[model samples]
Target: MNSNSDVTSRTVTALGPQLRRRKSIKHMVGEAESNSGQLRRTLGMWQLTMISVGATMGTGILVILGAAVPIAGPAIWISFVIAGVTALLSAVSYAEMAGMVPVSGSSYSYSYATMGEGIAWICGWCLVLEYAVSVAAVAVGAGEYVNQTLRTFNMELPVSLAGGPAEGGVVNLPALIVVVLATLLLVRGARESAIVNTVVVIIKAGILVFFSIVAFSAFNAGNFEPLLPMGAAGVTAAASSVFFSYIGFDAASTAGEEAKNPKRDLPRAIMLSMLIVTITYVLVAVSAIGAREWTWFVGTEAALVQIVGELTGQPIFVLIFALASVLAIASVVLTVLYGQTRILMSMSRDGLVPAVFGKVSKRTGTPVAGTLITGIVVAITAGFIPLGALADATSIGTLFAFALVGVSVMYLRKRQPQAPRTFRVPLYPITPILGIFACLFLMSQLGWHTWVVFLIWMLVGIVIYLGYGRRRSRLGQLSKQDYIASHVGENQ
Candidate 1:
């Protein structure tokens, strides 16, 4: 049997010169400041957990119930369970990796340490798609809810400023406004983002709990009698649609660098947030199902608000629901925007993306340039694209990234047995394998157009890698250094 020392030696030697060069470049690129400006380390386990919940629970639970219910009927509850379990598995995988690496880049940095450069670039690209597009989708959803809320007071924005291009509008000014506000908050630092997120999360949760209580009073047992009206396949399909709600679990992982004790805190945050979200979802699903027959849920936008209005017989409930939706969706945009900028910063550090992305503002100690660029792209997407289309596309990209992270955990266990890990996936091979399969299952249920768009995005990433990233990569340089170092040591 190989001794521990032997394993350590092999691991170090296997790092190769390319890794060293990459490390050197990362150090150089990250030299701007050790302090992340005024970003306070005030976030504890509770705050981090809430941040995850804030980011995940928004438009998904409040808005998506309508879309998903039509597909699976009362079995939408089962869809929530299925999606929750699958997401938990992947969240555990993320916890382990984030604990081990404890960096700002989330999956991108984890892949860099375990899977090498080319794979890391692909992971980073996928993350950009996942975070930026999801933010845009959430922003668009927020705009709709805001517009709906305003109309209740007899005030209305022009269609061009409220709706997307697909809905007979040239641009969505409200959506662009949402992205810009989130960007400004994020540029200030993590502490401000956390404070704002915490407040928004509380508001959103209170509204949901209120809805659940009020709607439950009107529950009719007969409403759920034909629970599986669409069968098990329908439940599975609905679960796939519901999986979008779970995409933000990775949001906590992106804060690895700012986390007080990353290894200990990350796992707690991921698991706790997921568990809370699952419970919240179950409550909302039960209330929605019990309030009315499953079929009535079809074709409704902002379905939770509709459920509330039906139960209370008051338009005031709709106004409150819309307000809750705005706060929740805005929180999602902020968290995801912060995540995308960090991933870009990591890629820039590795020389896989333009160095400008890696630049830290001396005053802010944040990746201001990357944040601005990401915000601009998301604003444009939200301004022109419909929420439904963007949601599907975001889900595909997110599932792909989740699948990669799960696979990476298993791969790293075999390839880097000696790497330090503060937390391990409880079931090891089984956990990660299940996570990979679950992600694939969800991806399979998405429309073919989503798959086509995802492929095109990946192709674009590959092209950029070949044209620029490959030549400038610090990984290649590090490998060369390791080879030379080994030979020199041998000669001596």
Candidate 2:
């Protein structure tokens, strides 16, 4: 009995540090405010809303519509609603969390505080894939559209100089150029990026509206003959793709720390931006299909520009549409790239990734190192890899992140009922539960190859966590009270 007791005590003592590791809500928030070398809180509600709009309305609307329309015919509009609703549900939960926490990591920090370090790491990992790869994907789309715009001027580059080999281009220099430009914008500061994003958003919105009016003039009811040409399965499958457009509303929440009034503005920006984007998407979808048969859009390089060109036979309109696409896609890349570095900065602050990612430049108040690293990786992916099915892969990663965020909201509600909340998710558990189910349903519609890749990526995250992050986690290094006390001491 004595021998057994001794062994048990030894084991318990050995496991104490690991077992006691806790990333509490308060500690996480304090770490963000005091220790992260925080970002400047310069963004107003409108600027924040524009970030969401700019990020959400880009490549998916401009490019994916060409690919998604044939799958659901004219009924691709319904898929937009379905995807939009799912995104809104998740956004509601995100709004509540963003209001209450108002931190930089977005869902990753929420998960860390509500769940545990392990789940938080996974969430952060998923976001890295979602933001970085989505940026790369959008960059490629932007490059293609820029090339199209140049062609209108009869200044077309060789296919070899335009894109990767898969897209029949050797290097995709234009895509690389846009990524580098976006990187420079981000490294300068978030406020400057937001200013540029706002201007881009206005220009893109104006062009989209103009095209919609023209498209409606040429609208033919014949395009509606068979709305569900590919059936319900096809609509749902396309919803899984269209869901990409909805992904960026959450980018607003990622800027919680930088919001001048996060508790008030973050939630408002989230819901408002999503509303604007949903309306814009519906108008564009209706106009595109009504103006031309859905079949006409399939496989087209610049579908919207082609629609406008076909409608008016005007090279000027094609030029305008092409310019809008380039601006819109560049803004998406900027916003998402900004969001990516912030997540990585948060992860680095928590010691889940390299310390270099955590370092914020005093002059710019930005994560310069992480921004450069992300920019280089995104540029390479856009320059070399053909984005065949990667958009679907990115959609899956985003859905997984959304599901976890919904789960985090519910978890926090139950675990910290007394925690101060500036906003609450509507309908309690139903909203969050629906958000989770919707994400899972959409995720199920993704192809098996996407799932395999996602699994492999997650497995790699686990290996990295175990090897480096698990022991090195900042939360592991400090006791909960110690962290709180340190912050209190600093304030005093």
Candidate 3:
């Protein structure tokens, strides 16, 4: 027993002061204030909701219908509903945690407060894949739409520059350009990026609404006859795919540090965003199915535009759809790039990742180095990888991160009941439990390859933690007095 104690004491001593900071609610709030004061708190509830909606609404809405409908038939509409509810539950859990913790790192920061240094590192690594790959995938999708729009005027890039080698071309130059531009915007600072994002959001949402209305004119009731042709399993499979459309709801949580009243706004923004996106998704899916047969979607480039063009019997509709897609996807790349940098900043502060990732530009108050590195990685992926594979990998990482957040909420509630929360999950254990199970179900539906990639990525995170994070962590430095004082002040 004595020998075991000695070994444990040595192990504890080795974790470093930063890793053992024992962040209390007060310190968490203080940290958020310090990092985010440079950002203007100009967003109200509605703008916040719109930001979430803009981030969540993207290529998935335009692309997934074709991919999902073949699996679930007309019943894919129901799958959208299922996926939306599951996402909403998780969003609610995130909202509560964001409100209570009010920190910028999303799951990474929350996990640190509740699960300790090691788990937080893993969560942060998962987010790297989620945000970076998402930006790349969205950029690739945007590139396709841009090409489609250009084709309206009989203008097209050389085949080599338009697609990857796997697609019988060489490089996706347009996609690379999009990622690089988004990175530059992010490095400039939050205010400008948010404004650009807001404009993109409005354009995208407007186009989606326009598509819904016009597509309805071509609606044929006959398309509804074969609902659920693929059965319940098919609907579930489609739900997993449709779940990708909801990816950006957590973007609101990442702004926990910047929100003027995080406790009041964060949860509201999350749920409201989920609600708006769900409605838009259901409308778009129903309209698309009513406009065309399901199988026509397979292997079709610019599927949504094609659907609208075919339904309306006018090529102009395709041009409009393509333009809308470009704007939406651009917003996704921008928001995701911002999220990646912010999470890295949080990890750097905790000393779990390189300190350079956390370095904020004194003038801009943005993570310049981190954003540049992320942009470069995204550009490489966009220029080389296939969109389908990148999208699957992103979904797997995001689902894992979401499930972890749900679990963290439950863990914190039970472990720190006295901790003040500005907002609480409406259904308590049921909401979080269902959220975790839902995320797990979606994750399992991803291809076996995605799981393998995720596992390998996680192993890399573990190695990094053991090699560096554990030794440099802020948590390790906390004395008993510091821990008690931090918690006590928050409680008061």
Candidate 4:
């Protein structure tokens, strides 16, 4: 066999050395903090929750609502609840794994120590798709809102600078600009980014709350007459579509290495962020339909503006809502981009990618190189790709990653029955099994085109693993030592 084939064949064996090759719980705990030049543990529960909150509460509500209300009618509020419940299953699994592993790779690192190197690579690859594409998708929506706000002031930008070729534009300048700004903020430092995120989250939440109050004042009970206009199927489809908003609660777990008290605080942050986001979404959905007819929301990108304009005949409120949407989308881009870079850094540390990505800047305590690389790639993608299909890809990628983390929690419980765990998934295997199935059910609701794209992405990941990552893995070196130790035990 050639050297590459030799490496690929043995990569599966990396999982078999559970007795000798498994990373001990204690080792992972120390590694989370002992590397003096590594990511600093500076985030507490509040900052970490804001990262998840700021990331989760963006374009999903502002953009997806326009597309979803036409299908689910006034019953769209039920869709939000369904999506939130689905997220909660995987989230509990995340809490358990984050508390146990306490590392930067999120699901990827948890899979490494429990499942094996190959699964870890695939999990990490899925996360890259999730975060990077999510950033691109959010940027596109942010650009649209920014342009709309400008037009409201009688300041029109050229079509070429405002959108992609799909929208008859040469390039998406506004989308590219937001990506660059978020990247610069990320490179500054994690704590600084967290602080900015907290401020943004407060402002975004306040705007939504104010919008809800205004919407409810003009409430007409008659608007909700035909709640499930399209029936249960429509609600299910809308739930699957709206699930994109909840993807970022898991981003909190990616900051495991930078959390002050990861074990207790990580779980708290995940649950708290989810609760806050779910409540906010439900209020907005109800108030929106109550404010006007559901037909008014269909095919409209600026539903908030349209609703406010109709309510008060005032351009000022419409502009305020438009500006808030712009800022909210920008914050989502920042948080998810931060997540993508961190995941790449963790994978790089395992020799699954180039070591350059793993480089930490001592002055900033951040992965500057990875952050810049992710920024450029996402900027290009945002500047060109249309948002429709890419958004589905982000949701599918996240569901896949969540399913893997859910399974990893179950596998670890069986393999390391005595491992020290500060937190554990409630109801044992039921929680993870539900999490996995819930993700699969939602994945089934997406169109066939999304599955085709997801499969192609997975194939590319497999090729990279065989061609480059297999031979270079740091885990291989450790596995060899364990292999020799196993033989030595046999001889003894």
Candidate 5:
């Protein structure tokens, strides 16, 4: 057994270096030379952290909890813990990978360098699920808050203008409008976008804290009766649903190419943002459940506002928080739309997607065309689809991307063991293995319809990869077979 194990280790040691031939580590000091790169690297550790915070801390906290509470009952906070623990497992793995493969594509770039181009393309397509679809889902939540705030003035946004077709409306104009607003901000450039996001992140994080404190004041011990009303399966199912809330925690990794210090900052921001989100989410969920009966959460679009209004009976307070939710949700749209375009840009650079998606305007140093196009598509989807369906789809995509990132990390650990990493997963293979299992377990808890949608999306991705990406992949000359043939005997 020892002799056989020794031979296996020797073969792996010989093959590892040959397998890892791809892009150089992308940590330019401060910023890339103006002539060297397209995207500007003006984002600091604070800005990068806020991007993750702003993007993930939105609609999930403000709106989705209302939907999740009924499923998990008063123990909804436990669902958050279930999901956050799963996310933490993946977040640490992401931190390790981001530190090593600090680039714009996030999981997609990491996969390409570790798993090969085909898997990388699939990862990027899944990212469209995570970033693009979540943008639309979160925008729908923002539209609800918009209508709720307008109602305070005795003016209501008509369903045709503010609600999705699934809700018996023609088009969700507020949803479209919100996406347009975020898109415009993204077109202004990354630095300006980051600054705006930082401000909103601080404001919204504060708003959540304010909500938790106020909720505790109204807390009733009776609300805690029968914590798991539907049983443990229900909490797991609700966790699957609320996993959508953690969707954009990887937004920091997507900005790896634009960070002032990608290696150090990317890992720090990824870990920090997820920690903040998990702690806040659990606190907020527990506080909310303590304040309101779980069954009353159903069909609530403005849950946080409703909770505050019921507790204080003050129209002004409700109005302020509702307006704050609008600003808060808009930040999610801004940061997520930014992440979506950057992922497309990275894929474009790799020839998996079109060059137009990768184009950066010299004036703005941003992907203007790509951002506009992404916003338009997301807007149209947001206008037609309901939040519940979109949220589930986004969760599946997120879990899929996260699972692959876990795989990517484990793969790199074996394939490039000596790679320079500013951070490492705390438990190495065990952490990544658990991350993958946790993501898959949660995904299984989702409804079958979500799986069907994911399959259809994968079919489309496969066809595109076969017709386009497989032919034009920029990693063409460095084909695995060609490299092996050239180096095998010589190295031996």
Candidate 6:
């Protein structure tokens, strides 16, 4: 009996540190506000809402129909609803987490405070893939639309300079152009970036409204006749793919630290932005299909512009539509690129990544070094890689992260029942459970190649965490006494 108790004591001691390894919610929020890691809190609810709207509304709407229409035919509107609802459920969970945690790490921070370091690292890794590759994907779409605009003036770049290597061009110089425009805005500061994004968002939203009006005039109810042409399975599969269109609703959560009233505004921003994005997506998808045959959408570039152009037969309208798309897509690159840097900054603060990524400039109050590095990297990606291979990869990564966020919400609600939250997920467990199920089902619909790529990326993240992050972790280095003190009321 003595020997068994001693053996059990030793085992417990060995596992103690691992058990206490999760970063306390207090410590994580404090670290965000610390002088060394602080970001300027200039954003109000409107700016935060715009960031989410700008990020979520642009990339997928501009390009996804061309790819998704063939898969689901006229029923693509249902796919949009499926994707939007999946995103809405997760967005609600993110809102609850944002109010309770209120940090720049978004889902990563939520995972850390609720789950543990291992889970948090996995979430962060998916975020890196989600944001960076998405920037590239959005930029590629912007480049093509920019090309459309140039053609109206008969000044389009030669094919060698205009297209990605996949399209037989040496480099997609126009993609690089849009990335640079966004990079310049971001490096300046979040306030200015938000201002410009708000302006561009309004312009693009107007252009979309105009497109809807014109499309309705040419509405062909016949186009929607075979609404379930491909059946329910097809709608679900296309929902899995088109879910990429709803990826940016959590952009507001990433701005938690930068919000003037993070606990109050973050939740509001997330919910409001999600509402706007869902309505816009459904409206646009319905309008587009009503105006044209689903068959014509396949292989068409700038699907919306084509619809408006064919409907109106006006060169000036095509020019206007193309310009708005360029702005819209650039805003997405800007907001997502902003979210990407902030995630790394939070991770670096926890000593998971390089310190350079965590550094905030005194003048601009943004992560200057991180912004520049991210810009250069994403620019190169947009310049070279074809957009087709990039799209599914982003959706898979995002879905994985979102499912974990839903899990995090459930974990926290049970673990810290007393924690204050400005916003609570409606219907509690059911919403989150549905969110998790929705994400998993959508993820199941993804192509096997996307799964392979995602698995490889996760493998790389594991290697990095084991080899470097585990040793350098700020949380791991904390003394047990200090850790307990830091935890304070989190466990209660």
Which of the numbered candidates is closest to the native, going by highest TM-score? 6
Residue lDDT tens for model 6, 328-437: 98889999999999999899998889999989999999999999999999999999877665467889889988999999889888988777889999999999999999
Instruction: Give residue 459's error in model 4 in angstroms.
Output: 0.8
The candidate with the higher lDDT, 1 or 5, is 5
TM-score, cand. 5: 0.91
- Which ten residues in a row are the worst by lDDT in model 6? 6-15
Across residues 1-492, which tens digit of lDDT does each residue of candidate 5 receive? 355653443344222332243433332222223323778889999999999999899888787799899888988999999999999999998899888877788888877766656677778889998888888878887667887788889888887887777888888887788899889999998999999999988888888998999999988889989888889988999999888889889999988778888889999999999989999999999899888889889877678888888888888988888888999988999999999998898888767788899888989989899998998899888888765654577788889889998997887777667767899998777889999999999989989988888888889988987777655554543444544553342211
Q: What would you estimate as the lDDT of candidate 1?
A: 0.79
Question: Which structure is stronger by TM-score: 4 or 6?
Answer: 6
Better of 3 and 4 by TM-score: 4
Q: After superposition, how far is residue 259 of candidate 1 from its true place, in Å?
A: 1.3
Worst 10 residues of 2 by lDDT: 6-15
User: What lDDT does candidate 4 reach at residue 63?
Assistant: 86
Per-residue lDDT of candidate 4, residues 1-492 (tens digit): 467765664665543342224344455556666754578889999999999998899999988887899988889999999899889999889988888887878988887776667778888889988999888988988777887788778886798998999999988998899999999999999999999999989989998998898899999989998988899999988988999878798889889888999888998898889889999999999999998788888778778767777787788887888888888999999999998898898888767799988899988999999999999999999998776665688889899989998988888888777766777888988889998999999999988988888998899998998777766775565545554553341211
Top-scoring candidate (lDDT):
6
TM-score of each: 0.90, 0.93, 0.92, 0.93, 0.91, 0.95
lDDT of 3 by residue, 1-492 (tens): 355543454365545444444455567778767766554455566556666776789988887777778889888889999999888888888888888887778988877777666667777888888877777877877667888899888998888988887777888888888888889998887777878888888888888898888778888878877887888889988898888888878887777665667778888888888878999899998888887777666666666787667667777877877887887887888887887887887878876778988787777877788889878988988988776654677777888888888988988888778877878888789999998998898888877887787787788878888887775665554444544666774322
Off by over 4 Å in 2: 1-22, 35-38, 479-492
Query: Residue by residue across 1-492, what tens digits does model 1's lDDT show?
Result: 245543443344332333332232134214323544523355677778877887798888877888899899887999999999999998999988877766678877776655566677777888888888888887888767887799789898887777787989788887888899999998887778888998998998899899899889998889887889899989998998888888787888877667777778988899989998999999999988988788887777777887777778788888988887888899889887888887787788767889988777767757788888888888988998666654677787887778878977886788666757777998789999998999899899988988888888889988997788765665553433453553341211
Q: In order, what lDDT does every prediction score?
A: 0.79, 0.84, 0.78, 0.84, 0.82, 0.87
Tens-place lDDT per residue, model 2, 1-492, is 255653443344323454334466666666657843558889999999998898898888888888899898889999999999999999999999998888889898887766667778888889988898888888887667877899898998788878898976798888888999999999999999999999999999898898899999999989977989899998999999899888778888888778889889999999999899999999999988899988887778678888788888989989888988888888999999989988888889877899999888899998899999989999999899876666568888889989988988887787677778888998989999999999999999999998988898899988998788876665665544564564452221
Prediction 3 TM-score vs. true:
0.92
* Total backbone clashes of candidate 6, pairs 3 or more residues apart or in separate chains: 0
**Cα RMSD (angstroms) for every candidate in the order listed:** 6.4, 4.9, 4.0, 3.6, 7.2, 4.6
Clashing pairs in 4: none
